[model samples]
Target: MRLLLIEDSAELAKWLAKALQGSGYAVDMAHDGQDADHLLFTQTYDAVILDLELPSMDGLTVLRRLRARGSTVPVMVLTARGELSDRVAGLNLGADDYLAKPFELSELEARLHALIRRAHGVSAPLITLGPLSYESVGRTFTLGGATLALRPKEHAVLEVLLLRGGKAISKEKLFEKVFSVDATTGQDVVEIYIHRLRKQLHNSGVSIITLRGLGYLLEAT
Candidate 1:
């Protein structure tokens, strides 16, 4: 999944971003609240990790703006403020979860997984679509009870498609989620991954359909 992390601490942000990427998530960083707010309106992210203290805008103000705009993207507040009042304010302002500073990476990841699952209306880690089953936390895909091996990019592509099944996702949107914004690769690379996935799942009961002018969709055979 794709996540936006709004953190002003340079060292902390870099460390978290790298850890998130290693865990199979495409992450974007914003050092200031204003930039994070702008990106929230312009781009789509599965969830957001926000810190309260910011340069251009405070995290609470950003959160308020986000809710005022009627955006329900899951948000997890991560900050050094561990006070009960701070946590309550964040939750009241539409934050999905809260994580204190000096927290374990494992706990942060677990909270993110919970947020994603709740957002998707999935209470269980194993997400099933037809004969395909995906373990969200493990980042493993199983088809017909057998493991399905895929390259990292290919796996990322399939994960997004499956999460948004039935909707036709534009190639540009897919590229944003699968590849970094600064990636040197061309958009055509998305098609290449799609082609490979189609071939890989040929005998499976799943199908990836191109929508011509639209983009691609995942459907059951």
Candidate 2:
């Protein structure tokens, strides 16, 4: 999935961005609230990780303005402030989850998975279609009770399709979610990954259908 990470700490932002990318997410980083706000206005993301302390505009203001504009993107507040009031403020301001600094990366990833799932209106960690199953925590796919091995980009493409199962997703949207904003690769790379995933999922009781102008759809056969 694509995620926006709004943080002021350069070192922490770099570290977290590397970690999140390693975990298979296409992440965009904004070191301050204003930059983050600008990106939020211009781009689309599956979720956001926001820090309460920020340069220029505060994180709460960013959240407030984001909501004021009727954007329902899932947001999780990650900050050093652990006070009850801070938590309440962020939650009230529309943050879906809160994690204080000195946190575990695993916990943060888990929370992100939960937030994305909820945003997609899915409640379970395991999503299944026919004999294919996806486990969100491990980010693994299984077919016919056996593990389905996939390259990183292939896994990313399939995951997005599975998350939005039965719905048509444009090639442009898949490109955005599978590649970071700074990626040097062209949009045609999405077709390559989609082609690879099709081979991997062949005869798995599900298929990725190309819809001409409408893009791709994952559906049970």
Candidate 3:
């Protein structure tokens, strides 16, 4: 998943970025509301972590503006406000969840997981397709009753294909899900990764078929 973190505190932002990255997420950071707003306009993120006490544009203003413009990306507000009124106001302005200062980093992480799950209509973490299985939170893939260790991008790309199992996925659509805009990757990179994955699948008699001018589809024998 790609997450946008809007925080002015460099220390906290860096720590959170590292934690999320370790958990198999792509993270982008913004120091203030202006920068955050600009990024929101430019790229798409699965979720947003907005700190209410931000400079230039307060988190509330940013939240309200984003909603007003009809962007429905999930957002969890992280701020020093823990009072009932503040929390109520944030919800009224379309904030999906809230986290207060001095909070356990675990709680913030959990809330984020919940937000993304709800957005994607997923209440569970396991994804199964024919003889293949995937555990989203664990970042593990099981193919043909054997465990496979895959790079993060490879895992993400395979998961997308497996989710669509019977449907053909265009390379453009796959790119949108696996690579964040800031990634220093070219369009052909997807082809390379899929090429590698195809070989691995072929070794086990599972097939990820390339559709010539189209993209790919997974077929299990």
Candidate 4:
């Protein structure tokens, strides 16, 4: 999934971004509230990790503006303040989850997974369709009770598809999520990956369908 991380502390932002990337999420970082606000308004992110202390604009203001604009993107507040009032204020301002500083990375990731799944209307960690099953926390995809082997990009592509739950995803969005900032390839790479995934998933009760102008959709046959 694509995530926007809004943090002002350089060292902590770097650590969090690295940990999140290692967990298979496509991450975009904003070091201040203005940039974070702009990115949240203009771009699409599956979820956001927001720090209450920020430069230029406070995180609560950003959150209020975001919700005021009718955006339902999941948000998790990260702050050093563990006070009850602060937590209640954040929740009232529309944060999906709250995490105090000095927390474990695993707990943060688990909270993010639960928040995103709830936003997507998925109530379980395991996603199943036909012979395929996906474990969110472990990041594993299996078919017919066996693990499915996939390259990194292939795994990313399939994960995005499954998260959308059969909805069509634009090729541009897929490229943005699946390819890295340093990737040298163009958007045409999405077509190649789709073709490869189709071949790999053949006869596995899952199929990748091209929707012409709409993009690609993954469905169970």
TM-scores of the candidates are: 0.91, 0.97, 0.83, 0.91
Could you give the candidate ranking by lDDT, starting with the highest?
2, 1, 4, 3
Q: Best candidate, TM-score-wise? A: 2
After superposing candidate 1 on the true structure, give the runs of residues whose Cα lies further than 4 Å from its correct spot: none
Model 4 residue 28 CA deviation in Å: 0.4
RMSD of candidates 1 onward, in order = 1.8, 1.1, 2.7, 1.9
Scored by lDDT, the top model is 2
Error of 2 at 96 (Å): 0.6
Whole-structure CA lDDT of model 3: 0.81
* Residue 65 lDDT in candidate 1: 97
lDDT of each: 0.90, 0.91, 0.81, 0.88
Candidate 3 backbone collisions, by pair = none
Per-residue alpha-carbon lDDT of model 4 for 24-140, expressed as tens digits? Answer: 777888999999899888888888999999999999999999999999999999999899999999999999999999899989998998888888888888998888899987778
Which digits, one per residue and each the tens of the lDDT, describe model 1 over residues 84-178?
99999999999999999999998899889888878877777888889999998777999999999987778889988987846889999998887
What TM value does model 2 have? 0.97
Candidates 3 and 4: which is better by lDDT?
4
Candidate 3: TM-score? 0.83
lDDT of candidate 1 vs native?
Answer: 0.90
User: Tens-digit lDDT track for model 3 on 1-221?
Assistant: 77898999999999988887776667899989998988888778789999998999988998998998899999999988889999999999999998889888767777787787667666678866666777655557898778977777777678667656478888877776677667788778889889879877776756788798877888776
Model 4 misplacement above 4 A: 179-185
lDDT of 2 by residue, 111-216 (tens): 8999998899888889998888999877889999999988777788888999996799999999999898888999999889888888888887888999999999
Error of 4 at 71 (Å): 0.7
Clashing residue pairs in candidate 2 are: none
